[model samples]
Target chain A: MIILIDDNPIDTFIQTKALELGGYRGRIEAFRSAEKALDYFQGISTSAIEADSFILLDIRIPSMNGFEFLDALQRLDKEVVSTFPVYFLSSSLDLEDRQRANTYPNVVGFLEKPLTRHVVAGLPGIRKAAS
Target chain B: MQISIFARKSDFQEVTHIKGLLKEWSPKVFQYGETARVGKLTREIVILYKPQLTEELIRIAAEVRILSPSCYLLVIGEGIPGMTLFHAQVNCALQLSEIGRIPELIHELKARAERITSDGGSMAMQELQEKNKELEKINFELDRFVYSASHDLRSPLTSVLGLLYLLREEVKAEGAQRYVSLMEESILKLDNIIRDIVAYSRNNRAGLQIEEIQLPELISDVEPGLRYLETGEITVSGCVKVKAAFPFSSDRNRLVTILNNLISNSIKYRHPARLPEIELNLERNGQHIVLVVSDNGIGIKEYHLEKIFDMFYRTSDHSTGSGLGLYIVRETIKKLGGTVRVESAVNQGTKFTITLPLAYA
Candidate 1:
C-alpha cells in the first residue's frame, strides 16, 4: 500500500499515475491534508496490515506542514509508526529543507517532484515487495 | 538659569524696586559680599550687580565665572572698571535706568537653550521618519513581487512540469522524443528565469546583514546547485581555485548571490574546446577588499561587456539565460558600496574585478 500525502489534488493524481506506470499494482491512499492521513494511520491495526506500506509526504502543506506532521506522527503508537517508512517528496529547492528532513529518523529519503518512473523504481518498500 | 541680586545695603530702595519687577523671575536676592551663596552658583548664573566695593565684587564675580563658565554678570551701577569687568566675564553693564531690560534678556537666553536642545532631537526624528518611509516602500514592493511570483510565475511552471511528466510517460515515439526534449529545455529555461526573478526580489527586499564571510565555504555551498541541471543535463564541470588569506567582512547572503551568479555564468559560457578553469582571488588593498573572479571560458565581445550588466539585456543570440544574472551581480556589489570592472578576450577568457570597502556601509 502507498500513502501519498499532498495538499495539491493534481500532484496526488500525477503521483498515482506515475506509480502505476512504474509497475506497482497495489492499494494507493491519497490525502489532501496531514490530519486526515494521521486519522487513517490511527484507524489501522498494525497486525491486520499484511503488505508493506510507505508514505510520500509533501513539505509545504496548508495548516500542518511536513515537519509538524512528522512531530504529530511521533505521538502515535511506535509499532504502527514503524510499520511504514516515510519519505519527503517536495517541490522545494531549499537545501535547508533537505537537511531538516534528514534529521527525522523515520524519513527514508528526500526526493524532488514530480515523481517520475525512475524515482518510483528505487522505493525501498516497493523493491522489497517485488523481491 | 539661577538669578542672584547682589546690591549694597545703601541701595536698599533700588534693590526692593528690582526685586518687585523680578519676583516672577525668582531672583535669589542676596546682599552684596554674600560669599556663602557664591560657591553654590553654577550653570547660567545671572548676577544683578550694583557694586559699591568694586574690587571685592569683581573678584567674587570672577570666582563665579570660573565655577560656571556660562555665568552672566549684569552690572547696574556706575564706576565699573573696564578691565575688572572683562576679567569677571560680565555679559552686560547696564545703568540704573535700564533695569527693565533684565526680564527680556533672561527670556532670550532661555529660548536659545531650548532651541539647541530641540534641534538635536528633531534632526534624529527626521532621519527616523525617512528610514520608516524607505522601509514601507520596500515592504510594498515585496508584497507585489510575491503575488506576481505565485500567480504569474510558479503556478504556470508547476502545471507545465506536471503536464510534461505525464506527457513524457504517455508518448514514447522516436521523432517526438526530440520535441519533448526541446519542450523540457524551454521549461527548464523558464524555471531558471523564475529563480532569478525570486533572487532579484529578495535582494531588493532584504537589508544588508553584515557578517564575517568565509569565501571558500560560500563558494563550496554555491557549487552543488549549479553543477547538476534540473532537466538531467550536466553542464560544464569546472575546476575552481580560491586564494583568500585575510578575514573579510560583508553581507554574507549578498556575497553568496554575487559569487553564485558569477561562477554559474563562468560555467555556463565555458569554451567547448578547452577545459573550464575558474579562479577566485581576495586581498586587502588599502581600505578596500579586492575580489577577482577570472574564468577560462567563452569571453564576451568588447561592446557586449559594457551592456551585460543592464537588466534583461542578453548579449549573445545563442544565450538561453534569463539575462538577470549579471544585473543581479552588479546590483549586489553596488549595495555593498563596491565597484565592478570586467576584462575579457573572445574565446579566451573573462575576468571580473570587484573592489569593496573593508567595513561595509
Candidate 2:
C-alpha cells in the first residue's frame, strides 16, 4: 500500500485513478492533511513500513506543514522515518525544499508533481535495493 | 453552528433519562454532548417538581450545558411565569411526561436526534476520517522512499559494477579515465546513502556549536577543496559583506557542509553554455540573514522545481548528484532556525534564497 499526503483531493483522485488505469500494482491510500499522516507515522512500526511503501507528501498544509511534520518525526525513531522511503511529490521546486528533503534520511528522493505514466515507467527500478 | 435547548429544572430527571437514551441508542440525533444535566448549569430548565430555586435551576442548567448543549430546561412548577420570552419561544418537541403516550413520538424523537446532533457527529467523524488519511500518507511515503532508494541507488551501483566489468577487459581501452569519472557518480550515491542515514536518524539531536566567523574567510577557507573544480572565471557582483548574530554560534562543520552543498551544486548544475556564472548574495532581513545563491545553469524544469531538496532526486536532465546534499543543507538550516527557498525555470537559470535566523548557538 502506498500512502499519499496531499492536500488536494483532485490530485489524489487523478493520481490514484491514473495508477489504477496504469495498473499500478499496489494499494493506494490518500490523506489530505499532514497532521493525520504524522499521527499514523507515530502508530506504525518501522518493520510495518514495507520496502515498496512510499510516502507522497506535499509541503504545504494548514496545521502541521510537511517540514514541521518532518521536524516532529525527527524526534521519533530514526529507523521508522529513514528505513522507509519518502519522496517529495510536490509542485514546489524550491532549492531549499529540495535540499531539506534530500538531506533528510527518511526522504529517499524528490519528484515533480503530477505522477505520469512516463514517470512511473522511468521509476520501475525504484524498489530494487530495499531488500 | 451553535444550538440552544431549554427545559425545566423540575423536568431534569426525565430529561436526563431521555438524554442518555439519545446518546446510547440514537446517536443520529442529539450527540453525546449538547445533552443534559439536572444541576448547576447556566441555562434555565423547566421545573416540574421541587428544587426550582433560581440558583438550583441555574446550576442544573449549567450541568446540562456542560453535558448536553442541545438540552436546556425550563423551571415549571405551578406555571411558566419565569420562562423568558426566548425560553417561552423555544421549539417544543416531545413532552417527556407524554413520551409513553405516542408511538409516533419515538419516531419523531429519533428524527430530532438526527437533526440536532448531526453536525456534532459529523465533526467527530471528520476527525476519524482525518486519521485514516494520515495512515494512508505514511504508507505512501514508505513506498516512494523504497522506490527512490532502490532505483536511484541501484542505477549508480550497477554502473559501478559495469565499471568493474570494463576493468576486467583484458585489453583496457583509453576510456578507463572516463569510465572512472562516470563511476565516481555511483560511489557518491553510496556515500550519500550513508550520510542520509546519519542525518535523518539524528535530526533532532542538538549538534549546534557556534563560533563567530567571517563569510569571506569561510569561503576562502573552503576554496582549496575546489582544487578539483575548474571554475576558471567568475564574478561576484557586489561587495561581499560579513555580519552574523552569534559572537560564536552554530556548528562549524555543518556550516561548511551547507556551504559546500550549495557551492558544489551551483558548480555542478551550471549551464553548459554559461559554464560558470555563480552569485552568492548575503544580506539581512528582519530576523534572518538571507543567502541568495543564483546560478546561470540549464535551470530546473517546472515539474521538478518543488522537489529539488528531496534525497536522490536528480532531474530527468541526468544531472548526477548525491541527492542528499541539498537535503542535508535544509536539515542543517532548519536546525539553526532558518529556512530556504528557490526560484528556477528551464534555461532561465535558478536562484536559491536561504534565510538564516540572526540568533545563533
Candidate 3:
C-alpha cells in the first residue's frame, strides 16, 4: 500500500503516474491534507497498515505540515509509525529541510520534485518491487 | 547647558540652598510630584539624591537615560554608604559639601559636559552602524523571501504543466485540445514570470563571479527561450560582427539575465503587423563595453519612458507581463557597475543602450 499526501491535486496525479510507471502494483491511497491522512490512519487498526506500506509526504501544507503530521502520528501510535517507511517528498531544495527530514527515525529518504520513476524505484525497501 | 534637578518636595530646602549657591547657573527644579513633567524637558539632567526615595531616583534616572542617552546625569546629595552602585550609573556624583566650592564644581561640570558630548556623538554613530547592519540583514531576508515565494509558486505551476502534458494525451476532443494548449500557454507565461522573479532575487543574494562571456553563444542560449514564447519569426541581426570580440569580461549570469529580459520583452510586446526584429550591437567604448538592443516592437509612451524601468510599472493594461523584467534588467546592470538608458516613441521602436565597465572593481 502507498499513501500519498500532497495538497496539490496535480502533484498527486503526477506521483500516481510516476508510481505506476515504476511498476508498483499495490493499492495507492492519496489525501490532499495531512489532517485527512491522519483521520484515515486513525480510523484503521494498527495491524491493517502493512510493514511494506510507504508514505510519500509533502512538507509544506495548510494547517498541519509534514512534521506536525509525523508528530501527531507518533502520538497516535509510535509502533505503527515506526513500522512504515516514510519519505519526505518536497519541492524545496533547502539543506535545512533535508537535515530536518533526516532527524526523523522513520523517514527513509528526502526526495526533490517531479518524483520520477527512477526516484520512486530508488526507495530503500521498494527496490525489489521496481526490479 | 540647561540643568534640571529632580527631588522630593520635602528636600526643597536643600535644593533651594544648592540653587542659591549656583544662582548664576539657574537650574530648573522639579518636585518628586512633577516626575511626569520631567519627561518634557530636553536639557542636561540632574537628580538630587534623596536616601528616602533611592528606588524612585534610580527609576527616574533610567527613564531620563531612555529619553536622551547623552543627557548628563549629575547626582547632588550626601554620599550615602550603599549608593556607590547608583553613582556608577550617572555621569557625575557630587557631595553637598562640594557645592560650597563653586569654581571647582563648575570646572568638573565643564569637563564632564565635554566628555558627554564626545561620547554621545560616537554612541549615535555606533547606533546608526548597528541600524544599517540590521537593515542589510532585513534586505537579505527579503531577497530570500522572493526566492522562496517564487519557488513555492513554481511548484503548483509545475504540477499544472505536468497535468496538462498528461491531459494532452488523454483528451481526444478538438475543442478540449485547443483549451489545453491555451492553458499550457498561460501556465508557461506564469512559469517564466516566476523564473524571472527568482532570478532577480538570486542576483541580489549571490555575489558576482566575473568570467569571460562568448557573445554569440550567450545570445543563442537566450534565443531559444524567447523564440519558444513568440508566434512570429524573431530576426536577430548583428551577431556575427559582435562574435569576433567573443570574450567580454563581466559577471556572465547577470549579463545573460539583462539580455534575456530585453530579448523576451522585445518578443512579448512585438507589433502585430510587423515581424519581430531585434538588433544587437556590442562595441568596446573607452573603459566600457557598450551593448545596444534595439527592437521594433510596441514601444513605450513618452510619459512612461521614465517609469518603464521601475518595478511593477507596466505601460498597458492589456499587457500580461509581471512588470519586473525591465526593473530586474536595470538592477542587474547596476549591480555589474553598468548603466542602462532607454529611448522610445509610442508606435515607433524602443532601444536600450547599456554600458558596462570592462572589469569588476
Q: Among these predicted structures, which one has the highest TM-score?
A: 1
CA RMSD per model (angstroms): 15.6, 21.0, 14.6
Across B1-361, the per-residue lDDT of candidate 3 in tens digits comes to 4556666777788778766766666777777666566445544446443523444555544322221221234443222221222333444434455555543555565565456445564554465578999999998788667757766877877677667756765788999999999998898778777767676776777788888888876775454334335332343332212423447888766776888888878777778788767777888888999888888888888888899899988878446778888899989998998999999876678999999997776
- Model 3, A5-89: lDDT tens digits are 9998889989998787667777899999999999998888777876578899998888999999988888887477555678887
Better of 1 and 2 by lDDT: 1
Docking class of 1: incorrect
- For candidate 1, state the interface root-mean-square deviation in angstroms to 1 decimal: 4.5
Q: Best candidate per lDDT, number?
A: 1
Q: Candidate 2 or 3, higher lDDT?
A: 3
lDDT of 1 at B28: 74
- Clash pairs, model 1 backbone: none
Where does candidate 3 clash, by residue pair? none
**Model 1 agreement with the true structure over B1-361: per-residue lDDT tens digits:** 4567776677667777777777777777778778556555542544545444454445544333311222235432222222222223334545546776767755764565455445553544455578999989979776665645443455446556766777876789966777877887787688778768766866776678888878776775575445324223333233678866466898876787888888878777789887667888998999999999999999999989899999999986557899998999999898889999999999999999999999965
B75-176 in candidate 2: lDDT tens per residue?
Answer: 221222222222322344434354433234334433544553453545444555788899888765764564445444443343343334334333356787
Off by over 4 Å in 1: A1-4, A13-30, A40-57, A67-131, B1-148, B165-170, B212-249, B273-292, B355-361
For model 3, state the Cα shift of residue A43 in Å: 41
Q: How many clashes in each candidate? A: 0, 86, 0
Q: Please give me the DockQ of candidate 2 compared with the native complex.
A: 0.02
Candidate 1 chain A minimal-lDDT segment of 10 residues: A90-99
Alpha carbon deviation, residue B13, candidate 1 (Å): 48
lDDT, each prediction: 0.71, 0.55, 0.70
